[model samples]
Target: MEKGIKAFQCVEWVSKRKVPHTIDIVDPDPSWPTTFTQLATGIRAALPATVIHAVHHVGSTCVPGLAAKPVIDIDLIVADPADEASYVSALEAAGYHFLFREPPWYEHRLFALYAPPVFVNLHVYGPGELDLESARHRLLCDWLRKCPADRDLYARVKRESSERAKANGEGVGEYTEYKGATIREILARAAADAAAAGQGREETVEAGRAETAEAGTGIE
Candidate 1:
């Protein structure tokens, strides 16, 4: 939970309609943690031994007292995400559908489970790629968790953004864009805090890499 990858007790692939295009921010639910734990367990069971390096419950949902859009955001850190063929097939068999491959975004690979009982955005990233996204994600989450003022501000901005999107007939994409300003502001503060504490992005990426090394390329 400290923005570092930790090996979790073991923890998908398929296809279906993508997530809904609407944005509806709701009060934080008590069940988010349970959902994440259950999902992590399922993922561990689905994958072959040693395929996953670390499983982290990231995003706003992971922060207590933060309102979110009711969807889980998970960061699936691997040794080398670019080597998708090594693990993608096993994930597909677990009922997770490949959504997109965005090399420009840290060679990120997104997978999702859109059926009942679980709605998650599985973000896969490797250590060698541009690790900006993973660093920012964990930093911001940890920051909001520690700072109550920012947490309230984020909740307010999210609610207003969601309402504005609904009133203006805007979709989730637009809502996300509308909230980008606030998100950046918060991230700026988080980044500053991280730097002041001598924590750098390279350290974060290396943490994942270290885990992968410990995991030892054991994909089946």
Candidate 2:
């Protein structure tokens, strides 16, 4: 099948389902890391050798002790994300469903897995496309894992945002907006820390990006 057609089918399939946005955060699950490892193993086995540039455990769940919705956000860095023909079929065969194709967003393609025991947002990015966001993801996870103060602040903000969204009868959009400003502030601080250490600053995560929330409700 053509990629465009497959993407359309995926969208239609999602529309027919009743997936809902997460309304609350939970304590960091000890099993999340293992889940990510298993998912990455499956993905690695499915891709061609040349396409497996890197696999990353990103998003809120990656940071130990950080409260998050129970979903794994993974970045599968490939040599050419635009070359869907080479990888998509194999991914499908491995039980991942291609739910999104965003050429404008650094040529990102998203796959989703909704089987028992695991839920994952598999994001594929080409070389240099996610350099900034990728750096932000890694550093933020590292910083939060080591710095208790920042981690507490982030968790508090997340709780407040969840409350606001629930009260406002809004979905992920409201939750994301209420959380974005705080996240940016944290990222700025992280960048400053990097600069002071003479490690240089990572670029903002939103630059040259196009993200869609319709794929699923998890905040990845």
Candidate 3:
């Protein structure tokens, strides 16, 4: 499904929990995609077919050979993220804990699974609600997967960011912020490449606008 363009907004977390945590960057695992597939299958089974619009494996973990934080990031496109009652309970039942919601930011909802099987960040967005952020996520993943140079560059930035965050006693948010500049640089290249190929112009424009507003906000 195609998403329309929208302005970026940094909405405060509905249920904010400010906690210091370790930012552990690990080598790429071959099993990450398999894990995402398993999780996606489970999510599909847990929710009604009519409720789910699309399921995507996004974030750094989706990029092969890219060093990441060992947490799987999944984008779950639904009919309406604001209508939580339709899908939240089922996700909770499936062992994903409801973390928070950002109604102003594309009606985004976040769910997490921090337990045994595997850790996952399940991001929910409504159709036409994920304009820029969604486009950026997909572009980044595809670019990194095919472009080894950018993939390596991102890996180095991630490691540096993790080290700096750890040294300063910062959490995931700060760590993510540290990598913003490099992320934008990489995305710009990806967008340029797409434009040259005469494809994904809409996605490139939307994603570029998103980076201009807030680079690396939703990345990883």
Candidate 4:
């Protein structure tokens, strides 16, 4: 599918059934990474290697010390997410329930696994489809890993959002929306830091090249 806002107009819900649940944000679990590793392993084993591009542990659960909902969010990059025939049956056989898909928004497809002791939100997308959104996820995760201040700030917002959602009988969607502003603020900081780091690297490389050229001229 062609990617862009025009594609979003074709958003389709595979199932309209809503699952009832409370928004419970918990303290960081040390086991989250291990859980992701095991899950990723199973997912890899289930599908053909040719179709799988990358599997990433994303979202709040992946960040250490960051409070988050117990659910783990994973990003599974496939050759073509819109081509469900290539891997959907395999994922289902592996216990993932196929969820809705947003064809316009990066050819995004969602799958869920509600097994006890571990809940997972498996997000599927094509390689180049999630360029911007994927970058945002990467930057936010990298920044949270190193920036204690923003991590704590995000945790506080998550708790507050969860509390408000529970009090108002809202679902996960509302809870996520409640904390959107804070997430955007943190992402902005992360993007600035990333840009600065990239510029520094470019300048350093240019300086090294200039020094090498000067040294070569003197040797002759």
Candidate 5:
């Protein structure tokens, strides 16, 4: 089932939706993809083939050259997000314990489970119900991959956030959200830049099509 998943669909989701946070700007671990591959395999084995569209490593940890919290943020694109009960039942059968569900924020249902300190955060997003979080996350990672200066700036914000989290002894949500807000601004800028580039590409393609049509008409 994992082998049947769509790679471009992952790209499309990132391009379309607005995600929560952007990339982490620091040295990356070469083993990130290796970790994700292992996770995806396990998820594929657990999830029912009918409901799981694709399981992705969509958070900062997935992106290379980013400093993440060492937690894997996996998105299980289910057929229906509201069918949390179905997933709850099925996953529990597969040894995953349901932890927290936050519906107010984009109707996104969160689940958690511990496997010997390899803590995983699972965000279940239903089909056609995407909010701002996913796309925002993709843009942040994309921008950092292309622009080193912005990435450096992001790393500093993240480090400062880490310090605050340490000094104040804050929880994961608080630390994540505060630092995330800063990255969101950068995501917005990257989004605008991307929109402009997309428009330019479309215009060029349209112009070529028009020329082709004119030449065809002349043949008649």
Candidate 6:
């Protein structure tokens, strides 16, 4: 099937189900980590050894003291995704189905857990060089954990968006377009901040290097 059609099909499938925004506001269960640990172990076993770099439990489940859906999000860094169609199929055989093929988010290939909303989201990103996946995952988790004030704001936005979408005819595409906008905004802001921080770190390193050179010490 065409990618667009497949996306629409996924949306249509999701549209039939109902999810309340309260799902977002609910306190996260402490067992979330254990569940994620089990998921990561299962995925590590199922994946082809060659393609794997690191499989991690990301998203809200990985962050302590953060509210999130009960679902688990796992990130996989592959050596080469384009060349590993077989690995994708292997994952499919393990009961994960392709849901979103989001390229805007750094060549991401998302697979959904068969159990539905509370299921797993496997984010496949290429190579160890692509730090975007892990960085974004950490940023979101950190932001939510440290900034409790944003939690309700996020929840309210999510709840309002969810209700609005449901009223206006919810489906995969529309739901994604709606919710994805918020996610994208958060990501964009985080990315800008990371770039700035990286620049500052480089500057600090350069200053340290000058000092070390003056001291006649070799670079570490």
Candidate with maximal lDDT: 3
Deviation from native of the Cα of residue 168 in model 4, angstroms: 0.8
Q: Estimated TM-score per prediction? A: 0.80, 0.81, 0.87, 0.84, 0.70, 0.64
TM-score for predicted model 2 compared with the true structure = 0.81
- Distance from true location, Cα of 199 in model 6, Å: 9.4
Off by more than 4 A, model 6: 1-27, 100-105, 128-134, 172-220
| Model 5, span 7-44: residue lDDT tens | 22222121211233222233556776787788778777
The global C-alpha lDDT for each of the candidates, from Candidate 1 onward, is 0.68, 0.68, 0.75, 0.70, 0.54, 0.54
The residue-by-residue lDDT of candidate 2 on 1-220, one tens digit each, is 1223322233322222124536477888988998899888888888888988899898788888899877788878888887988898999899777876656545667777776444777877776744444555666676678778988998998889988999989876677778776676676666566666666343443321222221222344
lDDT of 1 by residue, 76-183 (tens): 877777788877887888888886665544566778777554478788876644455566577778888989998999899889989998999887656776776777
RMSD of each: 9.1, 5.7, 3.7, 11.8, 14.1, 11.6
Looking at model 3, residue 71 earns an lDDT score of 79
Q: Measured by TM-score, how close is model 1 to the native structure?
A: 0.80
Per-residue CA lDDT of candidate 6, range 59-134, in tens? 6566676555566777787777555474777877887776545443335566766464356667777754353445
Cα misplacement distance, residue 87 of candidate 6 (Å): 1.4
Q: Clashing pairs in model 5?
A: 17-135, 18-132, 18-133, 18-136, 19-132, 19-133, 19-134, 19-135, 19-136, 20-133
Candidate 5 lDDT at 81 equals 70
Candidate that beats the other on lDDT, 1 or 6, i.e. the better one = 1
User: Model 6 clash pairs?
Assistant: 11-172
Segments of candidate 1 deviating more than 4 angstroms: 1-16, 202-220
Count clashing residue pairs per candidate. Answer: 12, 0, 0, 2, 10, 1
Compared to the true structure, candidate 6 yields what TM-score?
Answer: 0.64
> Top TM-score: which candidate number?
3
Compared with the true structure, what per-residue lDDT tens digits does model 3 show for residues 18-44?
222336888889999999999999999
